[model samples]
Target: MIIKPRTRGFICTTAHPQGCAAQVRQQIDYVRKQPAIQGPRNALVIGASAGYGLAARIAAAFGASANTIGVYRPGERSGGRTASAGWYNSAAFETAAQEAGLKSFSLTGDAFTDETKARAVELIRKELGQVDLVIYSVATARRTNPRTGETSTSVLKPIGQSYTNKTVNFHDGEVSMVTLEPASEEEIQGTVDVMGGDDWQMWIDALREGGVLAPNATTISYSYIGPELTQAIYRQGSIGRAKDHLEATAKQLHEQLASGGGRAYVTVGKALVTQSSSAIPVVPLYISALYKVMKEKGIHEGCIEQMYRLFADRLYSPNANEVPVDEEGRIRIDDWEMREDVQREVAEIWGRIETSNIYELTDLEGYRREFFQLFGFETDDIDYEADVDPSVEVPNVSA
Candidate 1:
């Protein structure tokens, strides 16, 4: 099978196994080159098959020699159609872990369910005894409450007032202004329910109850705080409300972990092209501009670099340098990215941006390439025309 990207919007229906393997290998190579850092010996990564979650899993297994259990939603390959990038990513990670003599298992199911949590806990007890680090990185637009059997969807619109901003179709490099209506009260609440910290706290409570979290365990969840240009649509929007809930939940989780010397922290990361971010309006343009500046400044990093830094420098630094936390006790890497200087420069460039000069001011090309690379489409080493098996099985996939 020659797998390629089949996209509707912000999602690629087909994925390439070989290409995903290449991506995993590339991340491992990057980790190998970095200065050695000590990390958790046993770990569990929720949303562990794609984007930042996948990078965290790679870091744990390769950078720290940790035994890891990954939870993700797997896609089925049908009729010569390839699976989702996550499915292929899991396969690649499992293969790499085995080759490196590390224990790794991937569970395919909903991470929000009690049954799933029980299965994960059972696996941890039977295999690794307890997890020293838990990375909560699930990013989904919808989730069904297993307890009530009620399905809910999340909205990413702004609150209080409708927002209109310049956006780019990174796919085609088309720049345009987009106007998004404000989210309703119900929409805001639903978004909070889906993306907020409730599920994260639930996971922690379940793990604690099942004795799956080791003493002095540390848990981290990913967050984002972009520039003022995006504040209305992001940090101060519907999704922002959800992030607020998540940040607050981290404090509560910290209290819950106090008895065992464990702690929970939310690490706000820089904007990058991911499956989730592409769907948000105005973000593509902002990411494009940010990428240009960061690249020029030699500070551009992908998911792997960001996660590696988070673990090596912030989470597991030997010197115990206090991870820079905001007043809310959440780590704020994105704050550096959202500094007044950076935002002002970006805003200036944004105002001058037109279709003729957009490329000069933004990394639109880079964004498109990364987006395609997520589904294994625009990679260099893979022979896309070569015959391959779409039904390749992921090792240690719990049925």
Candidate 2:
């Protein structure tokens, strides 16, 4: 059957397998061109199907020749309908990894649950022995606690006050002023529970207890801190409180790993248009402006570029002097993207932006293109009319 993008609001119901394969190929090629890094040889990546998680898996596999275990929630794909992008992405990645003569396995389930963790540990112990690095890059709106059987949802709102700002709908490139109501105390707490460090801590503790983490192991989680334009909706918002918990969890993880010369660090990555980011209010406008400025300055990076730099430059670089870190031992690559100069310039252009001048003032067009491309929607190389197989199988998709 011919595959094309089928969308329902923030998510696409279908994905193009060939296009997803092409995307994985492109990322692998990019990683191969860079200088080699002596990174991990065995890795575990949670949320390892899309966004930063997928990029991290690609970088580790291609750049460092690491064997990886990817854990993600699987989506339905049957009949002539295409699967979710993450499902196709995992299939494409595993195919590529096998062709490269590297070991890779993908598991689809709730990563926050004990049963999934046990299955992962058994696989790792049987196949890879121990993992030298673990990357946690999950970004979800809701989580059902495995222990308590309770479901929690996260919100994207500011902490102290209501925030009003100009936002854009990227779908139609319409600019409008919007006001976001303050998050209730329950909302705040729920957001923290869902997006916070508890799940991360659970993963680390399980890996540690299972004796699957190798000595001198390194663990990293993805975080974000955008410019003031998005502070109300992003940083300093309910999500920000969750990030604070995540960052603090890193400290505890660091202590746990210290005995083995291991370390845990949070890498605050730059904002990019992912499936998760597109749903947030007011972020499309900020991302549009940021992309225009960053591109003009020749500093724009996609997920692959960001993850590559995170590993080669920050994590695996032999020279400690070259590694960038915050005063708290966390990496702040997003801060570099949200520099004062860049924000000032973006604000100037943002103030002048209207529906008439949005394309000229910001990269709204580029942002929209990227958003669609995430689901293998608008790629020039893909022939949407061609008969494609929807029954593609990941090499090792454990139940």
TM-score for each candidate, following the candidate numbering: 0.97, 0.97
lDDT of 2 by residue, 244-297 (tens): 899999989989899999999999999899999988888888888899999998
Clashes of 2: 0
**TM-score between candidate 1 and the true structure:** 0.97
**Model 1, residue 205: C-alpha shift (Å):** 1.2
In candidate 2, stretches whose alpha carbon ends up further than 4 angstroms from where it belongs are: 321-323
After superposing candidate 1, which stretches have Cα over 4 Å from the reference? Answer: none
RMSD of each: 1.3, 1.4
> Residue 294 of candidate 1: its Cα lDDT?
78
Cα error, candidate 2, residue 210 (Å)? 0.9
Error of 1 at 218 (Å): 0.3
Best by lDDT: 2
Per-candidate Cα lDDT values, in order, are 0.87, 0.88
